[model samples]
Target chain A: MTIATFPPEPKPDPGWSRYFGFCTDAKVIGIQYIVTAFFFFLIGGLLAMVIRGELITPASDLVDRAVYNGIYTMHGTIMLFLFIFPVLNGLNNLLIPTMIGAPDMAFPRLNAVAFWLVPIFGSLLIASFFVPGGPAYSGWWSYPPVSIQNPLGHFVNGQGLWITAVALSGVSSIMGALNFVTTILRMRAPGMTITRMPVFCWTALAAQSLQLIGLPALTGGAIMLLMDLSFGTSFYRPEGGGDPVLYQHFFWFYSHPAVYVIILPVFGIFSELFPVYSRKPLFGYLYVALASFIIVGLGLIVWVHHMFPSGVAQWMRNLFMVFTMLIAVPTGVKVFAWLGTIWGGKLQLTTPMLFCLGGLFNFVFAGITGIMLATVPVDIHVSNTYFVVGHFHYVIYGAAVMGIFAAIYHWFPKFIGRMPYEGLGKLHCLLTFVGANLNFLPMHPLGLMGMPRRVSSYDPEFTFWNVVASLGAFLLGVSIIPFLLNMVSAWIRGPKATHNPWRAIGLEWLLPSPPPEDNFGEEVPTVISRPYGYGTGLPLVEHQDEIERRLDLQEASAA
Target chain B: MTDTTLTPGSVEAHGQHSGHNLTGFIIFLCSESVVFLAFFSGYALLKTSALDWLPPGVEGLEWRTPLVNTVVLVSSSGTIYLAEQFKARDNMALFRGFWLLSMAMGAYFLYGQAVEWSGLQFGFTSGTFGGTFYLLTGFHGLHVATGILLMGLMLIKSFIPGNYSGGEQGVQATSLFWHFVDVIWIILFLLIYVWQ
Candidate 1:
């Protein structure tokens, strides 16, 4: 992080010090987000393995019901709040400024505040495990009555801590939303119109907008629940005239919209990945961006689809069913647009591209299952079954995690100034792809076979499929070792990369690998064309020519 | 929307950072409003579900203190606007005077809330009605307190060698939040007191 490290060292470069406390650079914050979220991802993944181990048998042999409840509870909460959401946010904070060619995020200090809140509050949530109650055994949604006083983990303060942690994370997310939205709105480089901005920014803006609007409901509901739990209020206690369903409505209102909020950024990443790898401009660019907003609009109303089995009215479920089905249209447009992007160009099946293709495979399946689950009859049948588990994991774990991996692989050179070990990278992707399918694909039938979810033990009849899924999950867990070794070894001693390793047109790639601390020194960049100035007749300069030409001109400003 | 009047290859002008503060502040308020909306929504849900919205033993709230508090709060908005005007005119003495007056009014409104709470016959545990009332009003009161504290900082900063001479985004931001608080209180007043 020393500005003096101009022409920063060529090889021996594990640039890890930039992630130390209170650093306000969006790039550093981005790495912090990645590292922190990835740490949590490992923990959540381990919990899943524990779950898989228990489900391997018909008996609850791995842990007691209470402990198993604690395991899956933390699994869902940690994965959603601590890992996927923050990683996407980290990517946004890191890249959006450079992608838009801004000097920094609009609110640099606030951005740091948002990043720092995660550790404080994240630790708070994790702290629930060490307490006497042994972590919040209530499910992640924590519907009240059960989520209220003395329900499961209530006596030991873990439930209250979980609620507080979630509220804090919600606050952190909302603040990031504000920072990113403002940065995009006010910070785009000259000539980068909204339509011309990178599609990633559009998705980020769309996601941030959803976070801004949807998160408060969860935060407020949590606070209200907090009051009930701690302050002797009857907000959710039924004996005192509290209606538990109200909490459900509030929770779903935010949590459902948040499902798209989770994926939209990764969707944006795909928008970036498709063009650069395919050597083609994003097909239907405007529609791809517009579809995110359409998804946002549709995502808000379809939350009640989650409430279908929870005693919502028939009219409400039908209304949500229609809206939920409508979401498939825009989502389909995005999927086809990707297909159109990769149709006939000279394809580069690099690690990032491979992951993108694999993610799309998972996302399409997820979307199809989601639509199936939207149908009132189908949803009621599969409501709390392994099918529902399969559906969401396909979307979140399959789509979003794959996108995170792809974005990391694609941008690794840009961040670490070197290429990742390609063999190892490809191995990680292969194992992940196979492991994910083996893990989640079978759960559809298992769900259809009437295996209820969140159960520590089940009938022996369902053991085979559960064992299969567990084997796949173990494979998925194993997949991360190669990813970690590749990332670590690559950042330390991998081959050096030229600027613009992907030959992408985004403004960020124009700078050297591992862009300078201030990105553009002395002068902020001006965007002359859209980021998708890709393929035919676009001014695609060879990195060699630009490097040589710049050497002669002495215009390379910083390391 | 227009990129026509632009430079392409060199440094671009940063749109005034102050211009964006207001936009960001307004966005923050939108979220704050959502928070209230969630609470009011929950209150509505809980109220409607209960066989009696008002607990059997609880009487209606006495309206007079809240009404006076409302007037005090609404008037403080005026005082803050006047303070802004005076600042715009560079009338330092009057600017500080009105700003202080606005803070005083906010304090009075909060004091009114305390008196009204003391007069109420029920605790927050008294059932749905009592809980909702205290929660909404208490959260709103926190916002009011936060607004005043921000103003207090601004008021103190105004005495320093140089502050709010031309760019008073801080004062304006505070004023915007203050008004949001006032507006929410008005709605809260109508729902909690007037309707009752």
Candidate 2:
């Protein structure tokens, strides 16, 4: 009869100052990423508000035409590069190691380097606002000919800075994707087979793989564009016998899969939270996990759908149309799996659950419009219109952002060792859901009625929907107040959380709240079964009782 | 019970760690290859569409020095491989020798490239041909310089006693990168010099 003595507990949580410096601890880096990205998110949201304000009436009186272009371009660049991508990478840093029972990421220092590049390039991007030409007005795509024309004659122009920022961003993401794929593939604990891993990790694998394969094309393209703009390479100049459409091919090759890179993790969040809140195992779990790869596979061939109105050959357009529509199949499988998970189970409508539900509804709406946009006829008709704008907002904000919120709420306890105020959480969710629908829903009608996007002013007939959308945009702006208030207050003075507050079945839930410096310490919990074992009473880990006692002792000592 | 506990301080664990690093480096190289692919595809597209492949006054690329440069660069891959083999066999003297030889070959190749660039009549802004030519080769030359620098670091680190006591993963990764640079040059050689 041998009694096993527990190992020494890890050092206490380094206080808040750890985040400001170049720390290699994945948890600290994760929070830094999230906090920094949120700062950019607020900046992007403010830009959107300004744009909506300009479009409130039938005139471009609020800002100059050139300023409007810069505003929208910065808005798109900040939201995608700074907000969505970094925030998700932050979540990956926080969650992947804990879920897979690794003590740290594969290359922690490399991870820190990737994090610091965000701020460096993010500063460059924001600084372009103060530059000579006042930031890139050539849209986020920054296609050639227009992109190459540097009228200011200053070498350090807005388009130059934008391209430099984007190229550096591509480098940062490639480093991040490399780290993620290596960590997930190499660092899993004993008994955590590929199949037994949580679906979130699977989605991370798929999404990061897309980053590995697709990001370089855009990076390469950005470099060539920079060369043409600055060094007179003429790779995209028409007079220099360069093709502008080639840049479009390069940009969309990565940018189209980039949507999947954003949404796939949201899908993972949906998979994880549904089973926890609904008290049922994720239905067709294997299918849901494998479908992420399917999305990745299809996502690569479908970038030409974005070029339908760009004078692509008919065969190319039709081929990409089929590929784009095929994406809906895998996406549909995930939606079905979520519905089935919650169909007959005891549902807990917590803030996280509510957000997931809202996100799912919005995602389905977005998917339908996405399929419509996939069809060449419909896409050609609504090309460069508000309909395209409406559909993507439904995906990016209505679906992906809402899913991020759900993930934040669901994991807030684990992150900060406290329970968020449900009253405030629910209020925040209500405002966001209603405000988002009202803001984006009217764009469909406006697009069908022939109101083009990127214009500060519109026809007088389109003014009604614009008013509704602007009011909704203001309401959406208000929705952020409750969310910020709840996070700050709850983090400061909320009730302390237990190890497994939600009674979730995963390796992360077995650790202390705000898990120790090296998550799981010496006694890594070996995952025995797949995650999401809700209502099945199956033990998720091999030595569950022993691990729980060790965790409890650590928590007691820390307190 | 599928218990696959990797006990610390075991040889198997060390091998697994090295294997993990190799896999990561390979994946990184795969991504680098895609970046090159983007440029190559761009070159192919432009070549198919252009009315005149070369600028009006200038002749096509001179293949003599580039051919010698290609030979020098490609042969360096073999030298680096020999260095790794010697390091694996615990012959530190031969390992350092072959490693230095490989680095010299890489530097010689760079010198040949610079000489070729200096002699060229056309400049970067001359036309599509000059643009693609310089961009592809210059970009590739940058990679070669990076590989040489990595190899130089490895050579310096080897002099410190017990520097590689942990493992030779650094040397291995550097060699892999050198090889990747060599392979890319072959393709660039075909596209820019031979195919033209």
Candidate 3:
């Protein structure tokens, strides 16, 4: 079925109608991802507000413990699976082909299949909430022993559905990753060498490589867990002689690196944005690229950081601790390089740039607190507390979520052929910034004060900050209003954007707003300039001149 | 959009880079490797915790039949390569003969696996050893069955006059899959039979 539509274009092709069922147009597929993901983002946001509301009082009065369990499960489930990750992939689907000068994904049918599976899996997980016992209550991590016990009996059906849905999504991601890796490697236009490609493309490459190597462990682990629940297998049952710790080994082997999979592309987006807005080349471009790869390498070994309290071999714990800390080394280099890029350059404080800078600030706190959690002694004290909650949300909300908003504001013109309301964007950015930190930052201290997490309510002493956090969640809800309004208003009445409104140096800008059915006219040629070749004010090669001439000729002919 | 346009496929003049096929093959192999790696990972995780050493009701295979099947599977890889050579030389008859022979060899390998499975007193759902052994070889056999079907399709398509000829997309797809099956068999033989 036709899901959504963009406004008609200057260069409409008759061929597009034939491909309607196909949805081979990358922009259409990308829009499908964005709209679907945005809906889930709203649902997930409401779940969080409910959670904050319940925590506003000392008693679990707003909802019962079971309902609170479902609310938080849906919140984490929707945000992680349905919102943040999909937004990133949606952005990549829309933009990567244009950036690399390909017409669409290397495997078009596979791309369509990947997008289609998302909603199916997403719905199955959400459907679990309405079941008899509510959704999975084992927290988002769904750790074993605690996760395995279903005193709530919510365990069997709801959690089983959750695992299956996640596995389905895992397959979708793997297919997408394979297509991205092949297209980037095999189908890049001649001379678009790996180094000469856009920084975002490089990071996408690294992210997919992580997916390639990391996801199967999770899929296998899920199957084993399923076998345990459905069959009599003891894959994770200690009573059945299955070590619950083994499940941890398999889960984090994929899940921990999945954190990088979420943030690295966000880093890639910022990498592309900083250079364009700064009117300078990204500082230490090689180092940033290397840092992405190094993070991938470090991402693999640090899965055990999640296993610190599990009583693994002591030296093994120390080894994981050291590697976990070392991961920050590359991450720190990225933060420095971003700061350096913006330092002396003519920085344009566009809405997108503000979000990028804001992400950096939030990520710094996230990373430092992460370092705190990395130490074994600190982990034992803070493990499973609100402290852990505060740490992850900082990374997920402060880092990945802001990165998504930055991309949306930055790329809206290219996607929709119009500029969103600039004033509304700034307000959204500021309010979102304040609300998120106020909501999550106090969680750290609450955790430090020995307040356990995931409970519906707490002691009267914790009530004050809980109220404050709930107020911030309301403000967080308000922030999205401007974003939605700006987008809808821009669709109706905003001025149509020029081919390169931002004058960014990338192959995507070489085409019209909401690019054509074939992507390139007559011949979709390879790009020669580096994506960051801005401020040189020289066309990297004559191909852009030819494209400009062709566009002019086509316009004149139509006239 | 530069004037330095490289031809998309320069294989005609310089024969073939083998690198393109090799790279694509490597990527496919890596993905398949991860699936098997996942299964092996399950085995490793459960090794210490397995209920018993031998699978329930399983008996030893004769070893002679497995040795024969392994040799036959390896030899089919060569015969498939020969089929490709004949196709490149436009010898339709030779290509079809070798192609059909390779499919026959694959069938022989599958038949051998069936006999071996029958010999084992345990079935796939028996226990860890039974489950791992069946899943590993069973998955490989499925791949072999798929490969044989692909080969049969390719052989039939080759003789259909005025059908897309000589290094067409269909042929390339089939060849890629054949080589993939070959590589997986090598790994399965090592992990299941040879490694122990």
Candidate 4:
């Protein structure tokens, strides 16, 4: 192969101050998103501990009933909107342009605005605690009737702030979704056809598409709910001849698919990491890529499953149950594809791989419970029970959060140009896996035994499982210390990572570790083959030899 | 030598085939439409189920003013389209005239809505009918106001010579948004007035 000369690298990093300012660089904005999201994650985790403390006994001894309601409500809201969504957006900022060989996101300024909105809305959500009537006690779903009841009669009550915060989050995510979809569809390196793109991009496309189509309903609904609370519009109040069920329809229309928006990226993380750690090509790459859209199609129709127990028509319930069950087929396709990729390969058993494995295991369990909950009879039996809690926690905390940790660990080397301490990472993984199961698994039985959710006190008979879950939650809280330590210490002073540390075959790995300001500099790579060509000996980009040489030179100069 | 390297500028130029900003804006409009859909669905649901379609002791909406307003708003869509055409043909004067006319029409429609609101006996707190009616029209009225503001900005920008030299994507986006606002008004008129 002829060695081709490469262009000069772009300007060096602008140092740490760019992160604190309104920087438009996608990478900086991405790190800003991640760090800000992680801060909210710590807050959410602390609330979880408080919740566990209350649930440790069968009585509401740790906090007042209303206080407990505020804690758990904020916990769910912070974890979903403030943490998972923004961290995933951060990863999108860091990965999408580099993977596709674009210079930056389609709208870099919009991306920065999206990141800034996270902190804005996060502060709004946190500020609710100090407001009259405390935080929103109607849960994250914020279903009306209960939500519209402003007992304190303040115009700027907690529920009003909560609604405003949620509406702003909706606006931010919609903007983000537009940017991602446009970038993925329009911006790609030469010869990187839709099929040749990595599965992560495909998943991002699917997930963001859901955000575009579904989020607005929730936003519009929230605005109406806000009016009902503050302005007396009666969009949901029954005394004014409004229907409370309409709010449920509006809320679940997005909130149900909102789960998929969170998990699909985790699914993408799984697809990207499995092949790298297992030393194999992704099994059925085309199928895996196509499966994401299938999930999106199926995901939109299944929102009605969440409304099954809300006195929806019987025929509607039956139809939604089938739609909800059908989602498992596409999801199952991905799970099997991961298994097939890792089945007999030379598994690395790295920290990222371990987390992926644990995540996949948890996801399968969550999927089973999800299917069970989709059944009209089963859902009705455990509609408001702890069973519902256990099922989602397994998905959110167990699968999606674990998948996020995997991506962070997997890309840490690429993200910060340093290898995370493997010992700390493994300890974090073990504790998370054990604690997640211990925390959530017993909720299944509690739910089946008719232990209702969103309650501070429960029957004495439910105490044993609640104790186990509380202990598990405390352990889960402790699990974060090791991760934080690893990220900070490893970033500050760890072994330097070379590009392609895992020998991953993708455009991102073709660049120097931490990549340049403009990712590919002045010469963008022309993708020649599919990603995850681990054992095939196929080059990912044309001029692979020259690119490697140029990366080495760049690293040498930096050192 | 099969050379496949792409210059960084060319990489951007390659992706620029489809206008990135326009595409992003169109996607944004799709989300905006969904928000409107949510409100429409609420309105439809309440209309079907409520005991009184209109507030007690209040008559149905007067149709003549709203009908005239709808005609005015819908015609603005055509005027905005002409504005886009004139902008493309480099006729700045006609573009400015048509753009201003469209904004004037939009502002007139909002004025008509406010007048109609004042004429009504029932307020937002009257009943479900009053709530849905005000929310839907008020929301659409907000969009119309926004469209007028956007047109005003474009009109100002047009004064700076060579502003459209980089392509009239901004004008095109504003026109698209104005058209969307107009179309939503048609739907709102039919749902709240004509159908009722």
Candidate 5:
């Protein structure tokens, strides 16, 4: 007749086997995505090292042109598709339901299907390496004539496996997007309104909207390309009566917005981390959220920016130029907002916080470099050079990947009920940071000096920088060791983590660390006062009644 | 603040649509709209190019086959709407007949399109206009075929006692899908047959 304050004895759910489409345990699914993504991250990193090693000397020394193409192509593909997107979405799927006081995603079956489909699509892409001619040699962008004229494209794969891979991934993304949006919209507990949901959820919603709208174009493009290759209809071939430029138009149509798709959520993660670690509510929450939406919107129009030098009209070029420049304004709002969040608050220098701060610093430099590429004259010079390469790696690897690691380290306890080796995590962050800059920072100069991307080797003048870059890459490789060790060691013998290890005030803290098979015992969500009430003027007691209601609901259901 | 002030279920959740069928219809429209925009843009851009050629082999697309298909398709939309009206009024027999009639007319339209395709001289391989024509029409045809299949499934299910529960919302979702397909064909008819 008394409400138990804690689980009298850990009564894990036995009924979870019924929900078998996806891993019913949200934490398990989250870790599955994270660990697999981390594996790809290392593979991508190795490819990066291969690229740098080959470039270490001028004039085609280390690897042949074909292998070099495979290295960088798979590198970009794996990092973008296999690493950044999955890691972020995986984290979101893992965290958002728990964060918002929901027992599971509103559509858990769809969540399972989407998560599992990533590896399926991913293997098809990774499997391309062993194909007779080798992986998609037309570059990561896979621009036509070069891409379509090649023997191993969608047609020769004849299985439509390439198209199938991209589309399956697109399907996964669309489902994930829909689930993220619906869960945030419908399933929030009584008090958790639009304004009160976590910033990451808000960003995820915006990013997912971008995905839902943006991915269809890519799907349509891939479908058209598949038809072009398989059926000989000319979607992109002029000889077949299709224009290659049409493909570019359709391709950039998605790929440009995709840039935001990759970066914005990571930005969201940092947005959440900065405020939480700094012990401050996010500065300009409305602006940050609005900026995310604006970026998704404005991102659509700037696809032509990538095509400016490819013979687009001057006026069209200038139009995209202006839109491309305007992107900086919202981005500026975010940078200022983050700085504001960290400006005057108690700062936690935990490993996760270190990575967050490092990501911010690197992202600022990358943003500046991105702005430089937006200029007509500047882009004309560096359009196909290592500058573009360096710029993206900084954003994706330096900023987004770091943000993912920060989230993993920060939230590992919630998923696995054990802390990762913090000392190793810190060492990983430091080495990865130093090595990332050393590896990519000098490439800007190499690019300025006219070292082209996608080439096997460069001139002697570029030799020194490539060597430094290669050395840095090797260090980056070394840095990954700690993370892997930490993961393995934690899995083997780490101490069990306490619930609310960080004492963070979010609904996730209410659940058991590593959570139960059913997530929380209650099917219905209980309302909470605020998503981030810490450092706000709100009283802590505002959340207590709702928490008690959830506990009572769980107890009653159990009885 | 107390919980009493807020109404239960005030939260605006997605995935819930009623008789209006606005949400799914809108989503479908948005997707179709994007496809059409791509087609129109492709058309408009290509037409402006130096290759001022009509589809070379499509000289055989006599107006009659398309005009007849258009009539069949448009009338099926009306039939679907009438069926929805009858269902709303609980006229199960009328709903059943009209729904079947709508599917039949849809099948007839698709058959007409197939016959028309068989007669057409321009293949998808020929040129820009040819490729664009086949791609657009082919994609539209696929949608129509899917719509027909969905309606067939719904129609069969509706006949089984207690199968559909006379749910006002489920009936609306089906009606909306049919109406959407109907509207799409009207546009396709105008763009492909009449405009040319």
Candidate 6:
């Protein structure tokens, strides 16, 4: 029930209410991020169910067409800006210091400042939904011309609020990225070399690097868009001799790299989970780390692929296609590494591990389809179709969300000091895995069959598959209820777990569950062995007898 | 001998991190580069796509004021460098004086920019040319304003007994930012004021 105290020095505990407001502790901030992000995720998910409901009978029965646009736009905005990125960043804040054997993030106050920006901007974004014109209905990307000259975009408050909200989130992301980069690079334990650090930190470094470097491009574009909208600028207006496609260029420059921003951290979590569950030292660990850097570099160049259909020259199109395909090489290295890590080792099929495998299934499937969509010929056919939609969901929801859940379930004991109920956890995983596939899978065939996306009503011929897809989405919606119940109940009433619940070998496990005010109480931890030492002769627990003996010596001398 | 000692040289030597945070500063510079790159790319796109680099009937953009302001801004970077040197020698008065001078130069440049803006024939809404012109210069001016603010803070902090007696990281960061603004302005002057 208790971890061994190195010197038995007790520290003051922060009371429960410290979590309700601004607290500089990374653990508190991390929990704040997850709880707030989950609230947003529920909102986004509910909007998704509405989207599916509207698609059920191929008629605009449930909501008006314009309102439907607002639904999907808000859904994408919330799930992305509020849910995925922030949740991952929250984890980064919580786990980075503990994993690297540091007492806290390099800049703890800045970390708190970064998180506080989220709710302020997220409220601005969500509040856009209630205004007279509804939220920005030009889609989440909000490309100009449709996003600019049209009255909904030009004169409305919704688009303006959306732009401001996203820009604020951009500010938040920049701060968090800088904090992560500095902490990972400068604050590693003295004995822990970069090579010996966990894969999660490496991937976090890659992801946060891309964010700080890439997100400003989007911020600049948004400012230009704002000027065009409110201040009589023509940055994207063709009548004023500004090129619309150029805005797409600037937008994709940030957003295309943003795909890696979303995935690299999730992929990092994958690296951590597989080694723990499979009971093996990670195979090809260096390659896995190198692959993230490669992905970050390669991901930046392929933003042009999204601009292919819109007046890009033939040469540019081919260039982007090649770069997009080339990115698959580094990505392939990661997939193989995951497979090799689990190939001959013992596999623990716990819920967290099950979610990891589930996420892997989606990742591989999405990666292949992604490469298919990357091809110029195939993309020209399916650019605005359901195939693109399906492919995106498989990667975003299937991979990123699944990996997040895997991390959540795996680290629940560390956060809540209890294991999630296994039966319900498995059931939640099954429903999600089955529901996700059923929901997104049919869209592929429908896309190839020429079903255009973003339509509230479609051809009668598409109704059958659309109905089935709607059912899958509903199932996905229902799936989260059990997950929520499981988490809440498990946190409050589940059986207690020991400090090293999973027998994992990491600096995090060296401390008590839910840790102390400062993690690794009494003394700072220093690493002496490799991070993942499974199935090896290295002792999992370290003894600090010298330090303990010194403490006694000081006490004896005082006596 | 506690590490939290606020003496400038000791502060840099004390932290677990590189107190100069040169890497963080450089990374921030990269992000700022991307932002400015976006503006530059926008301008390029608009210029190539337009009938004229300047809008129809909009002629005679002033060059002398911006050129003079560019020199003034660039010289402020020199002044900040002088401040850094003065502080490194543990000369507090000269450090504070040169930093204040650097900020005054930045303020003078901003005033010059305003005078030039008042004389411009076209507004932001005039056309693509005017829009790009105003956006680029406006963003640059904002950076200069921020640089001035940061330098002012550094100057005030320098007077706090021993905060900048040696290896002042805040002052160095402000210098980097000011120099970055100056460099961006040079590029802008070359693009928008010179050539066709």
DockQ of all candidate complexes: 0.45, 0.45, 0.22, 0.52, 0.32, 0.41
Cα error of candidate 3 at position B164, Å: 5.6
Question: In candidate 4, what are the lDDT values of residues A379-454, reduced to their tens digit?
Answer: 9999989999999999999999999999999998997889999999999999999999999999999999999999
Query: Over 4 Å off in model 3, which ranges?
Result: A1-9, A13-21, A130-134, A145-156, A522-529, A543-559, B1-26, B49-52, B55-68, B118-127, B162-164, B168-196
Clash count, one per candidate: 0, 0, 1, 1, 1, 0
Q: Give Cα distance to truth, residue B164, candidate 4, Å.
A: 1.6
Please report the TM-score between candidate 6 and the true structure. 0.94
Task: Kindly list the per-residue Cα lDDT of model 5 for residues A374-430, writing each as its tens digit.
Answer: 999999999899999899889988998888889888888877778888899999999
lDDT of 3 by residue, A384-458 (tens): 898999899889888888888898988899878788888999999999899989888888888898889889878
Please give the lDDT score at residue A439 for candidate 6: 99
Ranking by lDDT: 2, 4, 1, 6, 3, 5
CA deviation > 4 Å runs, candidate 4:
A1-13, A556-559, B1-18
Candidate 2 vs 4: which has more TM-score: 4
For model 6, the stretches where C-alpha displacement exceeds 4 angstroms are A1-13, A150-156, A539-559, B1-14, B17-23, B165-167
Question: Deviation in angstroms for A182 in model 5?
Answer: 2.0
* Candidate achieving the largest DockQ: 4
When just chain B is superposed on the true chain B, each candidate scores a TM-score of 0.90, 0.90, 0.78, 0.92, 0.82, 0.87
Q: lDDT scores for all predictions?
A: 0.85, 0.91, 0.78, 0.89, 0.75, 0.84
A302-330, model 2: which lDDT tens digit per residue? 99999998888999999999999999999
Candidate 6 lDDT, tens digit per residue, A90-122?
A: 889888988876667777888899999999999
Please list the residue runs of candidate 1 whose C-alpha ends up more than 4 Å from where it truly belongs after superposition: A1-18, A151-156, A540-548, A551-559, B1-12
iRMSD for every model: 7.8, 5.4, 9.6, 4.3, 5.9, 8.9
Model 2, range B18-136, lDDT digits (tens) per residue? 56677788889999899999999999999999988788888787898889889989999999999999998889999999999999999999999899999989988977888989989
Evaluated with lDDT, which candidate comes out highest? 2
lDDT at position B44, candidate 3: 65
| DockQ agreement of candidate 1 with the native complex | 0.45
Q: What is the clash tally of candidate 5?
A: 1
Candidate order by TM-score, decreasing, is 4, 2, 1, 6, 5, 3
lDDT of 3 at A80: 82
Residue A308, model 1: lDDT of 88
